[model samples]
Target: MKLEIVRSCIFGFLLVIVQYSLAQEKPNIILLYADDISARELPIYGSTVWSLPKGGDTSDRQYRAQTPVLDHLAEEGIYVKTAWAATICSPSRAMMMTGRYAHQHKWWHNSDKGKAPNKKGSWNLYDSAPYTLEDIAHKGGYATYWAGKTQMKISGFNFDEACFTPGEGSYNTPIATTDFRLETRKINGQKKIFNADTNQEATSYVQSGWYWKPHVQLLNHPKATGPLEWWPNNKAAKDTFGLNTFGPDVELEFIFDFMERKQQEKKPFFVYHTSHLGHDAMDFLNPESKSKWPGTPKISWDGKTYTRIQPNVTGDNGVYDTHGTITESGIHHHINYLDYQVWRYMNKLKEMGIANNTIFIFCADNGTSGYGKGSPVSQKGTHVPLIIYAPGMNMTKKGLQDILVNMSDMLPTIAEIASVKIPDSYEVNGESLLPFLTTDKPKHREWIYGYHKDMQIIRGDFVLKDGKNDWWDVSENPDDLISFKKIKDWRAVSEAHRKERDELNKVLPRFNLHATAHDAPKNGLEKPTPLQLIEDNK
Candidate 1:
C-alpha cells in the first residue's frame, strides 16, 4: 500500500510539471512592420484628408491604395485607432525593439553615429545591449527570423536566421529575377559588405538598384545557405522564377520561406519583416524618372473584390521590364502591394493550419514623407496604423480599439506573448499589453507622447499639444475641428477637457530632450552638423 501511494505521488508531481511547462509555452509572433505610412492614409482609419479629389496632388491619390487583407484582418481582430510612433524611422524602430522612449535610449534623431555629439556616440539605436525583443523571444524557446531592411544595424539580436537588403543596392544581376549578389566579409570582426560587381570592397549602396534587378544577402537562412552572399553561394544564380521579379515581391518570398520552413516545427517563430514598402523613394527606380513614377499593377475591381495583374513575361534578364507600365500611383501601388502581401501572409498561414495560433501585427514606422514624415506641428507625422490579428488568441475588444498606444509598447507586448518574465535589471519604459489585450476592462494609457529633434508632444483624449502650442485643442469637434474658440485660460474649457489636459501635463517631466540642436540644454543631446549627417547616411 505504501509503495503504491508513493508511486501515485511521483506521477502526480511529474504531470504537474508537464502541464505547467505547456501552460508557459509561448505563441509565435510576427511583426509585419511597414516603412513610411500614416494612420490617415488608410480607409480603415476614416480620414477625410485623401478623400479630396486628386490631380492637384497626384500623390494623394495613392493613399487610396487598397488593403483588403489588412481590412479583413482588422475586421476580424483589433484596429488600434490612435496609435503613435516617432516622427522618424530610427527612433520609432528603436522604441519597438527596446521598449523604451528617446530619453532612455538617447536615439533622439536619425543621424549617423559619432557625428552627433552629446557624449553618446553614433551607434545603432539598440547597439548598447546584447538583448532585445529578438533575444527575448529566442531565449524563451522560439526560432527567430529577420528579413528586409536592416537599418538598425543590430549586430545579431540572436536571430536564428536573418536576410537583409545591404543598405540599398540595385540588385541588378546579369541573370535571375532576384539579383541577390551582395555578400558580407568580416574585417577586424565587424561585418563589411562586398560587392561582386566591383571585385573590390564596396561602399554604401543604399539606392543603386534596390527595387528592380535587386540585390540582397542571406545570413543564417536554413535551406539557401551561402558564404555571406545571397542564395546558392551568392554568385549569380540562374533566374528560376523569371522576369516580373519585383524586389518587394522577392522580400516577401523570404518571409514565406521562413513561415513555410517553420510551420510544423513545434517551436514558435518571430518575424521582423521591416519592409521598404511605405516610403516614397521608388520614383528614382522609374525608367522614365523625369515624367512618371512606376505605375501600379493594372488591377481590376468588382465592387468588393480586386483582380490583380498576371503578367506573362518570357526569358530571363531585364524581365522586370516586361512588368508593363506602373499604373498604380507611386506610393499607392506600394501601399496596395503592402495589402496584397498581407493577404498572401494570411493565406499562407491558413494553408499551414497555423493561422489560428500565430500573432500578426501590421504597423508603420512614421508617416509618409513630404506628407507627415517630419511634421512636428501635426499629428500626421506621428500617428500610424496598428492592427493586431490573432484569430484563436484573445484580444481586448475586436474590430476597433480606440485606445492611445505608443511605439514603446511593442517590446513588452512581445515579452508578454512569450510569457518570459523581464528581468528586474532591465529598465524598460513600456508596459506589457497582455492584460489590456486579453481583458475588456483593462485601462489603456491615459496619455501618449512623441519626440523628434527638439519638438516634444503630449496628447490626451481631445487635445494634442506640441511644446510650442498655446494650449489649443485640435481634435475636439471632430466634424468641425477648427470651430472651437481658442482658450485664454484653463477655465475656458470643459471640466472633462481641463481635467484631461491637467492629467496629461503631469507626465511632462518624462520628456527630457529638446526640439532642435539649439533648444537642447547646455550638456544635452546635440544634432550633428547637417551636411555631415546627410552626406554620411546618403
Candidate 2:
C-alpha cells in the first residue's frame, strides 16, 4: 500500500510537468494593429517626408515623429523592409484576419464588397473564409480578446471578448453638461456635421467623438451584464465619464484587466489591439483649429520612462480649454502617443512575469490617409510598417530584414504561434512565417501582392506593377517617397527586370474576380466557401 501511494504521487508530478511544457509552447500573442499609418510615419522606416501640423508639403524635418519604443523594438527584433496590405482599412483588415485576398474573403475595398442573398445584403468575412484568426486562437486553447477600432463585422467572428471604440455600435449618450461629440444631422436631405464654433459644414464624416469624451462598447466583458453592452455602465466607470476621457486610454484599461485575469487563470491570451491612433478625425475639441486629427493627451518620454499627463480640458458643447495639456494635432503626435502606449504594453508584460513568453507584433492597416489610404500608387497605399519581437524565439534574421511580407501572412503566423494547424484542404494564400522565423531561412517570400478595387498590384525584387497597370523598375531604393523608374517599354529594361515583370503579370490573373465596375462580385452571385473554392480550383 505504501509503494502504490509513492507511484501515484510520481505520476501526478509527471502530468503537471507535461502540462507546463505544453503551456510554454503556446506563447501569448499581442497583435498591435494601428490604423491608417504608413511605414515612414514611424521613425524606424527612415523617411524624411512628414505631414505638417495642419496641412502642407511633406518636406518638414520638424514634423517628424519621435518613436524611441519602436526604434528599440526594431533594434531588438526585426522590421520588414517592405510589407503590403490593401489600399484601405476594411479589405486590409479582412486580409489580416482571413489570410486571403479579395478573391477568397471578398472584402474588395471600403465601399466595394461581394453581395449575398440574405438580409445582411453584403457577404460577410466568415461567409467565404474557413476560419478567422480569433477562431483559430480559440481552437488552439487561447483566450481571444479584440480591442479598439473594429472595421469588420464582429457578429460573425469568434472573439472571446472585445472592448470597442466608436463604430461597433451606437455612440454613448451625452450628459449635455460634460460631453463633446461630432454630432450629425440631416439638413436639406444630406448628411452633414455643422461645426458649432465655425457655424459651417465640417469636412469630416459626421460621427460621435472617438478622442475626447469618446464612445465605447464592451462585449462579453467581465464587468458587463450581457453579451453586448455600452461601457461606463458600471458604477466606477460612470463617475469617471467626462470630457477628459480618451478612448484609447479606456481601451488599454480594459485590455490590461483582461490580461491580468487570463494570466491568473493560466490561459494563454491573443490580443488583437486594432488601435485607432493614426486615423484622422474631425477635431470637435478644437473645431476652429482646422486640425485633421484631434490632439491626444500629452506624454513626455525622457529616454527611459514615459509620463502620460491626464488631460485637463474643461468645457462642453464645442467650446473648451486645453490648458496646454493636449498635444497639437499631427500624424507625428499620433505616432508619439502610440510609442507611449507601446511602453505601457511592454511594462505590463514584464510586471506579469510573462514577458519572455509573449510575442508582440506592431503593424498598421493601410497607408496614412492623405498620402496613401485608398490610392493604388507605387507602394504608397499598401506599404506599412511590420515589427516583431518574440523573446526566446530563435530568429534567423534580427533587425531590418529586406523581405517581402503581406497582411494576409498574419493569420497563418498567429495560427502557427498558437500551435494550431490549418487544414491542407482549406485554401490559404498566406505562408506561415514560423519556419523562417525559427530556422536559418535566408529569405521569406519572392513576391508580395495587393489590390485596390479592380486594379491588381504585384511586386517582385526587380519589378512592380501598380494599380494603374503601370510597370516600374524597383531594383534600387529611391531617395524620395516614391521614385521608381516607370518603364514605358519593357523591351528597353534588362532581361531580369523583364522576367520579373512577366512573372508578376502572370500572378494577377489568379487573384482577379472579374467583378463589376461597382466592385461587387459579378452578377451578385454568392461566393463559394473556402473549401469549395479550393476544390473547384483543384
Candidate 3:
C-alpha cells in the first residue's frame, strides 16, 4: 500500500509540472496584413504586369521593381502561392477572424442591413454570428491587439486594444485627412493608449489622412470593456511625430512598443497589424507628369474638384476618377511603400531582441483589384499572398508552395504555433499549415471553395460554379479569359461537387441562420442573438 501511494503521488506531481510548463510555453504571433495587394504585383512572384518610372529606379534589375523587404521575408520564410481570401474587405476579414466561409458568417456584402440578423433585429458585436479569432485568443489567455483598418461592424469577443484608420473613398492627393497618430493615457499609473481607435473622426490636415501622422486617437482598457472608449483630448495625451511619417511606419512603431512591453512581462501576445499602404491613394506631392503619359491627370483625387483622375485608357471616359493610372508608376510606389513597412517590422523585431521568439505571418485578405476583388473570375477573387517566418524555422530560401490554403486556416495555424488546442465546439474550416511549415512535404486540399453570391469549387483542375452549375476547366485556363468552344453542361459538374457542397453546407447553418435570423421575429418566434444561434447549432 505504501509503495502504491508513493507511485500515485509521483504521478500526480509529474502531471502538475507538465501542465504548468505547457501553460507557460505560449508563442507570440504577429500578423501583418496588407490591403488591396495582388499576387501579380510582386516581382518576387514573377509578374511584369506593372513597371516603375524612369527616375524612380531603385534597383539594378529594372524588370524587377523594388521590394527588398518582401524579398528578404520570402527568403527567410515560407511563401504560399495558392492561398486565398474573400474578394472584399469585410467579408474577407469575417472569414479570416471566424475561420469560416462567407456563407457561414452571413456577411456576404459590406452593408449590414441587407443580411440576416440576430434575435435583436440587429447584430451585436458580442453576439456570435461570427466568433472572432481574437475572442478565441482571449479565451485561451492571450492578449490581443488590433491596429489599422477595421471595416467590420461587430465588436467584442477579444481585443484588449484596437485602432482603425478610415480608408480613402478616392485614391487621389498625398494629404487627405486620416486617423493617424498615437495618444497616451494613464491606466493604473502606467501610460497606455486606447487599445483600439476607430478612425471615423475626420482630421484637418491632409497628411493626417495618409494614415501615418498628424491626427491619431488613443483609447484605454481598464479590464476588458466590451465597447472601446477613446481618451479625451487632455494634457496626459501626447502626439506622435509625423515628419514625413508613412502609415505603415506609424503602425510598426506601436507594434514594436507593444511587443517590447509584453516581452518585459514575459507574456505571450497576438498582434494583428493591418496595413492600408498598398491600397490606392493619390500622391499629392508628385503629380503625374503629362509629358510621359499623354492625357493622364496631374493630380490624384483632386481636392479642388473632389474627383479621381481620368485615365487615358478607353472606356475611362473621365466620368469618375478612382485615381487615374499614371503610367502604372503609382502602383509601383505603393508596393515599394509596402516593402519598406515589412522591412521596418522585421527590423523592429530584431531590435527588440524578440526576432527568433516571434512567429511572423504576412498575408492579404483577397485577390488584387483588377483581376479578383468582387468578381468570380477564373483565378477566383479569393487568391492572395501568404508568408510565414519563424526564426526557429530552418527555412532560409524562397520556395513556391502549391498546397491549398485559405484565410480560415489562419486561426488553426496560429493555434498550433502557440501550442494551444482549439475547442471542438468551435467550428473551424481550416487545417493547420504547421505541417507544411515544419516539413517540406507537399500539401494539397481535396477541394478548395470560394464564396460570394456564387460559390466556386476547385477540384483538381476543374472549377464548378454553385448556383449556375457552370463547369469550367480552370486548370487549362486559370485566368478564365478563354472563349468557350461550346455551351457546357453545368448540371453534371454541380452533381459531381454535390458531396463536397453538402459538407460545406453543413458549416453554413450557423452563419446563414444568423444572417436571416432577424426575420424569425415576424414568424412569431423570438430571435436568438448571433451567439445564441451559434451555441444552439453547436
Candidate 4:
C-alpha cells in the first residue's frame, strides 16, 4: 500500500510539471489594426447607415460590405460588445501600445508634443514611458514585426523586424525604385512629370505617395530597399515589378513572409499590422482629375477569395499612366478589401501550419473618418470593433461579451501571454483579458475612461459621462444622441438608476483630482494629477 501511494504521488507531480510547461509556452500574436473604422461601420456590429438595400445588391452603393472572413471569425471567437478607444488616432494607439491612459502617458491630444503645463514643450508621451508591446515581446524571447500605417511616433520602440510607413503617407508613396517619386507639378497649364529628383522643398511634403510608388524606410535590415535610400541590389526587381507596385499588397506580403520564416525557425513572432483602410481623406479621394479608386492593380473578391490584377501603369515618376481603380470610393470598398486581406492571412497561417498556434485580433483605431473621428458629444468617438480569434487556446464559445474593454488592455494581455512581468511599481489603467480566452469569465472593469485633450469621458454600465459635462442614458443603445436628459437631482430617476448613478459618481473624484495636470488651464480649472493612496495592513 505504501509503495502504491509513492507511485501515485510521482505521477501527480509529473502531470503538474507538464501542465506548467504547456502554460509557459508562448503563442504568436497578430494584431490586425484598421484605420478610421468604427464599431458602427461593421455589419456584424449592426450599422443601419451602411446597410444593404432591400434587394441586397452593390450597385446602389448603399449596400454594406460583406466581411464573411471577419463575420465568420467573430462567430467562431469572442467579440467585445463595449470596446473603448481614444477619440483620435494618436491617443488611441498610445493607450494600446503603453497599457496606460493619456493622464499617465501624457498623449492627451493628437500632435506629437504634449499641450499641458505639467508636461510641456516637445515632451512626447512615449519617451517617458518607453515600455511598449515591442519591448515586452522582445524581452520575452519573441520576434516582433510591425507593418502598414503608423500614425504616431513612439520613442524607443525598435521591433526585431518591421516594414512600415510613417504617418499619413500610405496613400501615394512609391513602392519600388523604378516607381516615380511624383515631382512633376502643373507647369503653367499642363501636367508634367520630372523623371529626375528635384530640389523643390515645397513640393516635397511629409505626405508622400504610400500606395503606388510607396515612400518607405527600412529598419535593422542590411541590403534592404525602400524609401530613404534606393539600394543597388534591388534595382533589378524594382525595374521588373516596380511600376505597378501597391502599398497594402507589399505590407501583406512582408507579413506572410515573416510568419513563414518564423515558423521555419521555430520562433514565436508578434505582428502588428496597422492597415490604412476605412479612411477616405478628401485629398486621397481627388488626387487628380481622374479617380484613383478605380485605378491600377485592382483587387477583386468573388465571395470566397481575393484576386489582384496589377495594372500596367506606364508614366513618369508620380504620374501613374493608369486612370483609376475599378472599385468605387467610400468606406465600404476599403472595408471589403480589408476582409479579403484577412482571408489571405488565414490561408497563409493554414499553409504554414501555424493557424492552430496563432492568436488573431482584429480592431480599428476609432470610428469612420468623417462621422466619428473627433466627435465630442457622445461615446461615438471612442467606440471601436474588437474581435479575438485564438484556436490554440481551445475556446469553444462565440459571440459578444458585455465586459467593459479599454484600448489600454491590449498591452497587459500581450505581456501576460509573453510571460513578461509588468513592473509592480508602475500602475497601468488596464487588466489582462487572457482569462476570457479560456473558459473562465472573471469580473472586469466597472467603468472605462477616455481622454481627448482636456475633455474626459467615463463610461459605466448604464451611464456615459460625456465630455460636454452632461450625463447620458446609454443603455439599450444603437446610441442616438437626440435625447439629452439633465441630472436635476437624485429624485429625477428611479431607485435602481439612482443607485447606479451614485456608484458611478463615487469614481468621478478619482479622475477630477488630476484636473490641474494640464499644461494650459482647461475650462479655467487647474487640474492636478491624482495621488495614489496605498493602505498598509496592520
Per-candidate TM-scores read 0.77, 0.89, 0.66, 0.78
For all candidates in order, the CA lDDT equals 0.63, 0.80, 0.52, 0.64
Off by over 4 Å in 2: 1-25, 171-179, 188-191, 194-201, 516-538
Please give the distance, in angstroms, between residue 327's alpha carbon in candidate 1 and its true position after superposition. Answer: 3.0
Give the distance in Å from residue 241's predicted Cα in candidate 2 to where it truly belongs: 1.4
For model 2, what is the alpha-carbon lDDT of residue 369? 81
Please give the RMSD of candidate 4 to the true structure.
8.5
> Tens digit of lDDT per residue, candidate 3, span 213-267?
3233332333324344322233333253322334454555556667777778777
User: How far in Å is the alpha carbon of 378 misplaced in model 4?
Assistant: 0.9
Worst 10 residues of 4 by lDDT: 529-538
Error of 4 at 35 (Å): 1.0
lDDT of 1 by residue, 62-100 (tens): 447667778888998888878889888987887788887
Q: CA shift at 78, candidate 2, in angstroms? A: 0.3
The window of 10 residues in a row where model 3 has the poorest summed lDDT is: 290-299
